[model samples]
Target: MTGTIHNRETFLSQIASSLGRSRLSSGVTDPEWKHRPQDQVLQDATPDELVDILKTQCLKIHTSLVITDAKKLPETLHEVVANYGGGPIVTWKDERFSKWGLEPLMKKEWPSQKLEVYEWDHTKGAENIRQAEKANVGITISEMTLAESGTVVLFSDKDKGRTVSFLPATYIALVPKSTIVPRITQAARKLRELHHSGKQVASCVNFITGPSNSADIELNLVVGVHGPVKATYIVIDDL
Candidate 1:
């Protein structure tokens, strides 16, 4: 234990000495020394520009992006489901979805036998993933989106579990265009502020960029090993 402590102290001392030497050699002080971050361009980007960048990045990351007006979202979503051969769908229970008139549309469009819509239940715990895994598709509303990395951030809980994005064969995400930021820093800051404010933030905050892919075994490409093989991002402009 003593030796480990001494080694750790030596490592820290070496780091401090190197930093001091570098600072002394560079005669100028960086603005970061005062703890101020660089100017955030993403936060200043217009919503429309951010959305455009997000769409482009999504394609590069192998994630499909569907843009539809708020009024046409239901039909658009239905089309996507039909293309996937409408089956079981696991979705996060967001109150906004019902208000957007999706619930009625779903009930009318999807018959009980033809389509099963499962709302993630908090009481199920780890079993939530099991339910989602059985579904053909999973859907969730993204709280924030990073255009830089083509990532959609989901805050999950009993009402909305990360399983909706991680377990299904196809993951569909509703990303409000307004939520699209230029990068991840702003998304992280928003999350931190929410947590600092004592809001009921989710235990699992997920950043999903695209469909799961790995070139692991003998360099053979594999998809959907860890998560959904297909990820669809629906950018709802009106929202």
Candidate 2:
């Protein structure tokens, strides 16, 4: 009976592989991704200029922010955040934000501010969600940043709650220059590589291009319907 069961499982596995429905047997690696153009990647692109761009492209600055570039998250964040009103709470995604060594930085920069960082454990409950909804600003790292459209991609998982990025009135992104892809096609290629690596794609992979703005009411422009009203991207140099 055991042998029969094992054989049946193997047969089904083979069929799934043939149909390209099997899980990733290989880890995170893809040569095709390496060939993507460097020009397409987003970067610092003038922090001062970004301020103006956000004004024209964005609808409201209610949730205004100062995002740090990915590589120079240390350098840019400390300086930029100093000017904004002291935020009540600071949020982060679990893996990348944790690995990037933000705890020490947060302590140093937001010493007096209430600092709250959560891991994507799914069971962490919904406190982060509720806080984010009322937060003056929300900060997180992006999987990819699009320079062309000035967008950031948030891949929410167990640690990085989706609400931390969306529910907040203001959204700030820390994007690494290297992760800035020129087009959606390049992003798709990278996504395929990530999927093939057996990693769990977050239930919500949100693509945020500036703040939420719509001109649906007969030429009247409105912002913050489905997401944030204010958005800012901090494109950091490679660390």
Candidate 3:
């Protein structure tokens, strides 16, 4: 981000000089932006209200939202898997899945299980991408969520690869209620604190609002052009 600012300064300086305007210098710091009505609404929302607002915003962008108990996550995941039918499942290595007791649903089941799922190996580099490309579902746990825009924030790591949230037909985000901030600013503040505290922040932090869609071709809306055809956000009430 700092590098981006430096590049922007150079580019803007050239444009400003051409227009005979004052250059946006590197020393210039923009004033902090005030909150908009949408932002303020989220900032003052209760937990339930935040979820409702997030769900509404998510639906507007063609993302499905589901609320479920932490303990019932296995059942919810089963339904998601059933909806997608049996296929290769690629998931990020989040400890929350284990804490939520979704092992039975994620891993190979016993002899009498209803459905069998192929768990993609959590590897690195091209191998992981190769596995995820053929996967039907990409499951990940959000580090935090933005209620104002219904965005799920994912950080890439050794356990959670970047492609784990992309390159799949279906993307499912498992977010805990506690991790859902009232707005994006709050989320950014938390991450900034973590960074300043000397905690190891991941190299990539992806803020996903919805499935990849575009209407640039001919004005007709298109879905899943560069991302999942279906995106689902499963919010856990208790985590």
Q: Please, what is the TM-score per model?
A: 0.78, 0.63, 0.80
Ranking by TM-score: 3, 1, 2
Candidate 2 whole-model C-alpha lDDT, 0 to 1 = 0.62
Better of 1 and 2 by TM-score: 1
Q: Per-residue alpha-carbon lDDT of model 1 for 1-239, expressed as tens digits?
A: 23334576567668878888522333566464554353455667778878888888887777889998778887788888777767688887788787666985346454333577778778878777788889888889989988888999888776887778888888888888888877877887888899899986787888888889888899987777788888889898874
Off by over 4 Å in 3: 1-41, 110-124
Candidate 1, residue 36: CA error in Å? 7.0
**Lowest summed lDDT over 10 consecutive residues: which window, candidate 3?**
110-119
lDDT of 2 by residue, 1-239 (tens): 23334576678788889998975566877456655465445344554454445434433333343445455565565444444443544476455664665665545344554534333335657766667767666778778865455667888766678777777666677776567655566677788887899876676888877777788889887877777666666665563
Best by lDDT: 3
For all the candidates, what are their Cα RMSDs to the real structure?
A: 6.6, 8.3, 4.5
Please give the range of 10 consecutive residues that has the lowest summed lDDT in model 1: 21-30
- In TM-score terms, candidate 2 sits at 0.63
Candidate 2 residue-wise lDDT at 199: 70
CA RMSD (A), model 1? 6.6
